[model samples]
Target: MNVRQIDPKQRGFLIVNSHPAGSAETVRRMWEQIPCRTDGSGPVVLLLGHSAGYGLATLLTGLRRHGIRGVGVAFEGAETERRTATAGWYRTAAADSLAQGAGHDFVFVNTDAFSKAGKHEVLALVEERFGKVDHLIYSLAAPRRTDPETGTVYHSVIKPLGEPYEAPALDFSGDVPKVGRVYLEPADDEERHATEQVMGGADWRLWVEALAGRGLLADGFTTVALTYIGSDLTAPIYRQGTIGGAKENLEQTAADLAAVLGDGGRAYTAVAGAAVTQASSAIPSIALYTAFLRTVLGDGFRTTVEQAGELWDQLTGAVPLVLDEQGRIRLDGWELDGQVQDRVRELWADPEAGLERARAGADWFMEQIRELYGWGVDGVDYGRPVETTVPWPTPGVSHA
Candidate 1:
């Protein structure tokens, strides 16, 4: 794993896959576990938020295996132990790419692109280096935020839009997580707009315009931003909530950006399957949904890496990416299959059925959450001391 310097002051940081600490045999084991596709420079890709466990990191690795040389992200928030662990995961991906001799180079800029200045810096960095990228993959989530341009902050609400929607929520305080119908508050007009402003496609549009205006887009450049639309179980706060409105706006942005991409380049809102991530766990009712999903799908519950591999296949002409009637990419096919949803809804409908299944399988969901936080790696010895510091410079200013 390697990182490139994107700026002189170090306000931007990039961290990739890491090399081993012990014997050469250990290195070999690490490589053995990592996935590397045979050969192909698939694309020069710019990722806005490619970090571990949320799909982008694995997507980059998969593309490198298929011959994607340049990969980078204009990322934010890399200070905690969790982000550091993810940096190590990225390092492993890079190591695997090189070991396969696929000729891979990745970019990771640790800076927020929500602000006007941040977007300019990002575009400059891309224009100066990668020139024009073949694809742009953006997968990001945050709470309340404002447009840096207007200096008007908008807060994202987790509440339902019209009426309070209740669903079985995952309660984690116990030794064994339990699920029961939980009611969430409703959102007002202002709250709904706030959710859209913060979680919506406005920031995504900013990034795309920045890259495209600066002539940083390759011919047929494709861009995608990940979204989620859970079953009726999460409809209130997810599929039909204020957050869902933001997703709709995001999809609309996809349509608009697709027009701008023009020559074979398309924009898509790739709705992903349910899985635990730094972003999703914080949302209400998702943990419960994921636990039931694990019970129903078993081995079919996809991690970000697996889903990303499929996405690369679709994008690189290896396979066709099926779309919904609305034309957006439907990556959540497996999860949203009628049969699967039927069973999931059944579990939700029957309290006893849902609780029993959750009791059996909720541990998997919880463990995956721990893994996202850097707890479940094979070689990691929590008993030992490890470095938690990063070499990159951070924005010295404090957040108010």
Candidate 2:
């Protein structure tokens, strides 16, 4: 199936498009590229938030590269009439594609990771089926989270920390730039806790504890979480921002999880460079930074699939470790490059420089942003009508 035709008028982030067949085909191709494991024993990988963008691409790469058989979970439902298409459909198509091509079992869980019951159900499924998972990847990024116990929902906000800062945001519909402040209502204490609860480590701990309790962790099993370390310019809006706070907590959780893994197991945090992920697009300042990063990184930039491949290699010991001066894994070294950050800071200082020294860079950056939504993508035929319906995997189907 060809990529779905996107309407030119949609303004906000377009994470989910109606492209079940295209997504399935993408997954099929990814499965073909995975190298077979030499040990003759397949790995079981559990991927959370495996529906769109980086998470989706990571799942595809893991299944393809490591010869892993596993389950994927996403909170979105199938055929929801919401602004974005249901993630359930994409997960179903992805699982079907993997099952058909790799002969591996692919299960999709349709529950929000924020809920206690949802977390429990996922653990129970893993216990009942795989018994233990070899690797766990947490790639969840949500704006708000609801406490199942308290029935209180927490909404996230993006606002200026010190003073009102005006940044250029793309008016996707008008295809023009309008200066706007990243302002939203301040989050209350409950909201902050809820956001932390939803986006933070409670669920991650639950997954690890449940699996550990069941004796599922194989010797040398690894858990990895994706994170970012944007420059100081974007730090308040990002790294130290509310979402940044959540990410910091996530990093701490990774360290804690490492201790829980004992000697044989490991937990790591990969500071991935900026890309057009579903979650990143929602942040106010990220788009501009992403555009700049794309320009500087150029065509050499890795897709989420490529990043996932690197992540899997690191986790499985296929790739040698490369540690930064700080001793953390350096997947996002390109972003932290002195020259790249200097140039970005200059652009941030003078917006007109975005128009000056980097015309090709600006154009390339904008193109990458457009391509995030499957629009202006190279080599795909947009004029062709494609089938929307693809087979969905049953909830409890097991490969083992």
Model 1 segments more than 4 A misplaced: 1-35, 38-40, 74-103, 392-400
TM-score, every prediction: 0.82, 0.84
C-alpha-based local distance difference test score of model 2: 0.65
Give the per-residue Cα lDDT of candidate 1 at 12.
9
Give a tens-digit lDDT track for model 1, residues 239-296: 7888899999999999898887787688998877787766777778788777788888
Q: What is the C-alpha lDDT of each candidate?
A: 0.65, 0.65
Q: Write the per-residue lDDT of candidate 2 for residues 1-400, one digit (tens) a residue.
A: 3334444334455544544444444555555665554332368888888876667777767655556666787776544333234434654566555554556666778788767778778777777877778888888777776766687777765543444445654334445443344554444555456556666776677777767876778778888777778777777567655666666677788888888777988887777777775577777777766666666667766666677777777777788876565435667766778887887777767655564554565556556545544455545565776545444667565453
lDDT, residue 26, candidate 2: 50
lDDT of 1: 0.65
State the weakest 10-residue window (summed lDDT) of model 2: 1-10
